[model samples]
Target: MTSPSQEEDDVEEWRVLYQETFGYRRPLFHPEHAVFQFQPDPKFPGHQRNNNRERREENDVDEEEDVEEWNPWKESYEQLSRGVHVMNSFEQFVGAADIQCFDHIDEALKFLDENPEGHHEKLIFLHEGTHNVNHTIRIASDVQIIGASSSEDIAASVILTGRHATILEIQEGARSPYLGWITVKYEVDTEHEAEMALIMEVDAPPPPEPNSSGAVADNDDDDDLEKVNEIESDQTTNCAMVVTGRGVEPIIESCHFQSGNADHHTVVVKDHAAPKIKNSKFIGGSGGGIIITHQAAGYYDTCEFAQNLRSGIRVQFQANPYFYKCAVHHQGEVGVFILDDGLGHFQNCDIFSNAKFGVELTSPNANPTITECEIHHGELGGICVHEEATGQFLKNRVHNNAFLAVWICGGANPILRQNEIFDGKHGGILVHRYGKGLIEDNEIYGNVLAGIFVETGAQPWIRNNHIHSGKQAGVYFYDNGSGILEGNEINGNTLTGVQIRTGANPRILKNRIWNNDNGVLIHEGGQGCLEENTVFDNTTTNVFIQTEATPTVRKNKIFGSRETGILITDGGKGTIEDNEIFDNGQAGVMILSEATPIIQLNRVHGNRSAGIEVSSKGECVVRENRVFRNRFGGIMIASGSNVADSSLNQVYDNLDRVSKAIDRGHCLFSVSGKEFYPMHNFYRCITCNSSDRNGICQSCIKVCHKGHTVMFLRCDRFYCDCGADHLERSCCLRQS
Candidate 1:
């Protein structure tokens, strides 16, 4: 049994022996490999390369472990196994079907130009060495130019260095010509005569043949010539490769492209040309790595771009390209930039470590879709869609960014859905500067700032997202930000679940907000509609409204608070109506500090303290509410505070009926405050009341039952029936 390292040494020795015999480095192979066209040399006689070697059992080792080490010429081995004849050198070659060999590339091209009738598919192999040309080589037929490199580095071994305006041009009418395993480098100063290293354009076709009348017919050939001249004489420079001409499609694989100067891009595809580029690398370019514009499109797979001066890839001018599994990193600017009506789709790509945003889209006409990509470690944000751009970002994992993971600003209206955005230094998503977005179904957490932040007059519709475990608020609206927040689950934040301040007015509806310091905090003149929400189990209060905040809290279920269900303080004023407030550690509704709210139609019960407590100069209109089943007294009003018009309130079934005892057996409207105490008279309408708890105060008697039959009562059990359904007419006191 041979050691693995010894076997590798033996293979290398055999390769060297074959190289000496064939005048070219040969690939060592096992019997199971592809068939190779190995020509016999007179000096080798009857000795066969494979037959002379000791064979090994296939089951002795795993195929992957026994595989050869990766080398630049490995692809050539596969090609050879496919029955491609390997030439010893460019000058000495045997022929195969549609396969041609030439000592110089120019000669081979000249032959194709001379005899262009028969061969639609041709394979031309270039020897592994530098091929210098003064003029551009144009291909107008379906041909494949493959490099036969035997060196450790394919690109370095099969180099194409040129100082011409263009190195290789695939003209119009060419059908998917392939260029593989080669390096194309521009050598001239970019500021000079060189316009591009490679250009594909439509050239003038052969003039129409003479007809029977012995005259050439007029056609669009002249127009074609003019277009060609325009492209050749264009003043714009510094693009290493250009793919132009409508409907032109080419294949470029396993190639390395380098620019001439700091202002040269590696490739530019425009004018609707579509190319298929695979397993290539664009590195250290002064300009962008690739530019797709002018309605051009391309499919790039398993490519790499790094250290570019501009964006790794830029798409504009209605171009729509697809990038699959590409690695774009270490860029001087954004990893990918789409603007100027650009549209692209990126999937399964790793974009990170860029100087700016990993992916950026701008302009009103820019719309792209990015999916299933891992975008991280950006110097700035992971993705930015601004300047009125629109895009769809779905199912991406964007994390560890220096700023917000995704920023939608400047009137942009992108859709961000089903993405996992977390662990950023800033917020997960930001909509600012009048931006608008539809952000939904995303899992955003572990950010230093808010999970989703809308500020500076931006309005974004946020829904159905799981935002939790953040250092700051789950959702923040500031500086006049306004939007609709619905169907989101926000919890476990270090700060408030929803923080609305600084004049922000957001409609929060149908959301479950819990397990935060404060479930909802509306302060600093903030105002909005908080409706149809479930706010519970907060560390502090379920809802805190303070500092002149005036929000409409309606149709919500607020319960299970660590403290009060709803805390209104510091001049807070709002309409808290139609809510189910219960099971709080403290008062169901606590009001203080001159805060005035309209507390109406709420079912306040099951609290450790009073169902509704107003103190410290607080004033409110407590009307048409059912206050019951509380541990403390119902509707407790302190000395300096008052319920301005306590009408139609059924305050009953409390552990302590102290508020009813303090009412002095008078109607709630009359005993709620000092101002209303003068009207202490109580009455009962025989037609409306069937029990001692059904009665009316003097204010309600004079205003609500003006024409109904009534009877005087001592108010032994004081309650109001004016707002209930027992009356023939609506109560005037309750209406007011």
Candidate 2:
């Protein structure tokens, strides 16, 4: 509302204040500090009048200046300049000076070249704007480069693009090139098909040259010039970040790396470089998230690696990487792949939902330790250790995998202890192809296959585990596999608790096996010892030995089986001794189909059928067994079978003491060493001292011995007085 002349005078006063306070040749304004006011100077009245006339004449040249508004509150020039100076001082102290701000990538390259020796305390700050670095910018030793606040801010402020070229290179002899608070993204439509955004090359310092006196000359002037030229020539590769160095320990913190190329990794640590990365994220790369190779080692803390085309982390060639509390998921291949002697240690990490195995290790000596981690929802197994890889898998929860929770093959020996491996489509742990290790103190259940499966000479020490509720056997050993299963609780399985077949020889000891279809099955030439095990409450035979399997089952308490306690059939031969076999629906020991089992010193009682039944050409030596309280006879030898020696067995309290089949149709009686055709055969009573000599025939045995209970004997010599007097005398009363 002021007059035109007064308004012109007020604008002139502000212009003089700004020029005197800032001492700038050109006018400058900041949008953020627009509310700050200016005061006119008092000492330069004639000079300010001359400047007012010059500014009024220049305002006519720019029409936009006429519509510009000024601040309402008036601040003195001293106050305004002091606030700006304080802020600028702090910014400059933190390495945010005007010389550090570079609008073009060439300016940054020139600055790096000028500071060849590298100021240790200096930090290069890329200004808040897009910077298309057409070539690589090599950083010197002990130099630090810090970008804007965050990855998103850097993305909006600095956009780096290169065509088949690396964006930044931390050159050789550069020590501790620390990169923080930045985002390095690779962008190229089609012309710039580069695969890298930054590369750190670490090389050893040049050796001193020999002078004419055969002594070492410390001449490094030409070497420095040659190194600069070599760095300038190495700007034409393709990667997101490549660390190629020997004995280099790079520190990267709070950085984000993403790539659009399908064959580019977000970060690659190669050639013995050991990098420590903290609180970083690698996302949306088509090649892989992070790769460590050529004996490189990496330590990552609280990082996230996701949405990669290949494995989230791929390590090979003796590279060792340690991941702490990181998340690796949604990968195209396995979450972490370690091969060719690569070693990895993953602790307290969440690895899930990958296309392949959660962690796959292969090749010789590729050892990795996965402890206290949750690995689940993998397309393949949770962890696949194959091809001579050995490590420790301790305290991990491996579940909900499509295949086995842990698949071991090709002689890989890994110690799996105190792990909860359950709810998988296949077995909980599978060992094949000569794989051997110690599986101890694990809870393995709810798997589609057996809880632990060992095949093809895989000899693992499976002990102290609780394996139950599996769709198949709790522990399955087949294909010539030999192992020791001790102190395990195997129960509630749909099939046999422990099955050994196909020539598997496993020493199963001290395991509580119950509530399964068959407690333990040794079949198909499987030979082992089932000792000190408590096997009970099975649906079928507690211990089934068949198909030429010779398992020495001793000192086992086997009871509560729906069928026979021990069924040895199909030429299976072993020693069954010192076992308590009772409370079965059928016989305690049933040997059929030519099976030859030596049964000794076993308490065989409380069964529905005979305590020991040998039939169908089965030959067994039943000796020193206490056979009693059975519904059928104590020992029943069927028609075609024979017990070679059934001695010292206390057979009592059964329906009959001992029942044996006798072919009476071929009986020929001989009297006084003369063979004669007799009408029938008579038998003697051993227990009763019978005065009545009632001779009994095979057909009418009950009528012949009305009040005398007798045992019909198959005597090939005589048809004499068969009474209690002659029972203890001889086999035949023949007067020769």
Candidate 3:
């Protein structure tokens, strides 16, 4: 009845004494060499015993306590024993053959060559710690290769160190080959760069044939010849990942791929191969992380691509890749580059910190849908849809990029909605080179330039966005760019809130434009419709129209401006109608520099200067405006060739009804005794007492009518006698 520790010490002393007497040490038993045996526990007869004997001693000491206590090590051991027994039963059920174990690449290849077709549906284990498989290893159909846990357990997994080559390839007709827990590393020379570390080549489907002609050939063999040609064309062709006549999809899971060569790709799936990769990591590749091209498709889940020299994932030539919960970051180029008619759908992905654009969709007809993604902090831009590429960017946080957050160019149309694009070096969104799309409900602000810039004939519908706090205009449309800007809050910009210049004609409607240099500036011949926009509290004019730009300004609440509410200058002409232009520092509507704007039906009041001012060389049609309550004249018509067709306007309640400044002897009208009279005579008395009165001189008012009640009169022509309205009786002479 010895204690376990005391017995262990006695046995160790005896073993050392025996070893010293024999002049040798006992051989150590390795875990791999020792057979795993299971024995039933006494306390729980059905359950297997744990390898640790002290647990059995403890159970014997307190049986009741042991029955209730939970031992994690015992539980794990029992579970592993049951798993091994179940596996043995399953082996019997499937008539499992012996699993082939290889210590070297040549041994594995030799075994595969010996049992080429016979080893179908069998399992192979690689035991090599690390094998530099310089040549490509083609996996057969229904064969699965499982690597050891670590490089020490099996020599390390396959490493493709060859130049201009791939390590492992599933050739044509190799259906459903499973590759698990494999590591592929590349160290190719730069002179002979490799294409891909691992490539899966499959046969592409044949193209659809055209319809046959109705005309029957004289030879009956013509039909047979055509059938033969069709069969020949339908035959499988050789390409990368050639999966010809295969039913099961090739899968590579739990694998790590790395490369350093400039032209090497971590993995390439081409020629219609559809591979599913899960829980894979691609790191430090000089080429790209993964490339699916030539109509090849892939489904990647829970994958990470980091620090690649090229794009993290590149799909081209009609290749379609769907990624879920993937992180593609710190790449040299774009995180995801879809081009050449390639289509990709990425969901719940993080694509950021790339050298170029985070996600770039280029080439004609290439469309990618990126939803619920955070694309930010790239060197160039966030997302680029160019060269006729069309895509949908929904609920993406694209910000803090070098240039534009979302750049659409070269006739591309991308729908950007619910994206927060801000804190960038340049604009938030740039649509140029005929790019057109719907930019709706996005927070585009905090950029160096405009929040949304449309140039070079690009026409994008920008609506319901908060485009504010920008260095330049909130929405700038130049170089013939035009779009529908509706329901946007464009404010707090350093320059104009919405600037349409250089012949751009953007329809601006219902936008809150405030706290900018100019609320809406239409200059350089830009033409558009500014309607129902609340443009106020601007540092300069609320709505500035200059340089021959003509925009129809209607129904806009333009007030609280530092300058004129609506300044039309420099030959600008448009219909200014029904706008509440008031509370400005200068004239509410200033028409200057030969500008002829049709100002009609506007409530121009509460201004510091004239309600509507027409300066020298300015000729405008000002009519039907309620111009009142201004600090200066209601309507100021300057001298020196300024002409304003001011009519039917309620120009009253101002400092002056009309302030007409006259210089020199070019008399416009004669004002005398609180009335404006037309001057048609210089020397004759236009106002006389009798009808047959002689031509009284200008001195008659002072000499003849001395101490008499003399009334002032407005005469139409220079006549000798005055009318009865001005005189007490009719004149003696008949005045014509």
lDDT string for model 1 (595-649, tens) is 9999999999998767888877888899999999986567877656777767579
TM-score of 3: 0.68
Displacement of residue 636 (Cα, Å) in model 3 is 2.2
TM-score of candidate 1 on Cα atoms, chains taken together: 0.74
Clashes of each: 1, 8, 24
Q: Per-prediction RMSD in angstroms?
A: 14.2, 16.9, 14.5
Q: After aligning candidate 3 to the native by TM-score, how far in Å is the CA of 106 from where it should be?
A: 7.2
The positional error of residue 582 in candidate 1, measured at the CA in angstroms, is 0.8
| Residue 24 displacement (Å), model 2 | 28
lDDT of each: 0.77, 0.71, 0.67
Which residue window of length 10 is worst by lDDT in model 2? 665-674
Q: What is candidate 2's lDDT per residue for 1-736, written digit by digit as tens? A: 3445675677566655554433322332212221211233333345544654566577664433444333221233222232211112223233213223445545554566576565412334443444555665655454545443223444344344454455665545655766654567665447322211222233435567788999996655542133432453222135566776775666776667766656656677877777778878887786788888878887899999999898899888888889999999989998989888888899999999999999998888888889999999999889998888887899999999998899888988889999999999988999889988899999999999999998899889999999999999999999988889999999999998999988888899999999999999999898889999999989988999999998899999999888789999999999999999998877889888999989999999997667888876888899999999976568777655678768678988875311221242211223111221122335655444533354333422333334556776542212344321243433222221
Residue lDDT tens for model 3, 1-736: 4444554554455444432221112211112211212232223211213323456576565433423233332332222221100111122122112333344555555555566567322444443245565465666555555443223312134333343346667655666666655677766555432222121122333544555875544543442122332332111111112232223366666667776656546777777777777777887887788877777776888899999998898888787778998999999888999998898889889888999999999888798789998888888999999998998899888888988898898989888989888988988998999999899999988999889889898999999999999988899999999989999998899998999888898899998988898988898989999999899999988988888898899999989988779888888888999999888877788877888889999998898767877764777788889998986568766554345557679977875422331222212222121122212222234344443233222333444444554444322223222222245533222132
Model 2 segments beyond 4 Å from truth?
1-99, 105-121, 127-130, 149-161, 171-174, 187-237, 261-264, 629-633, 653-736
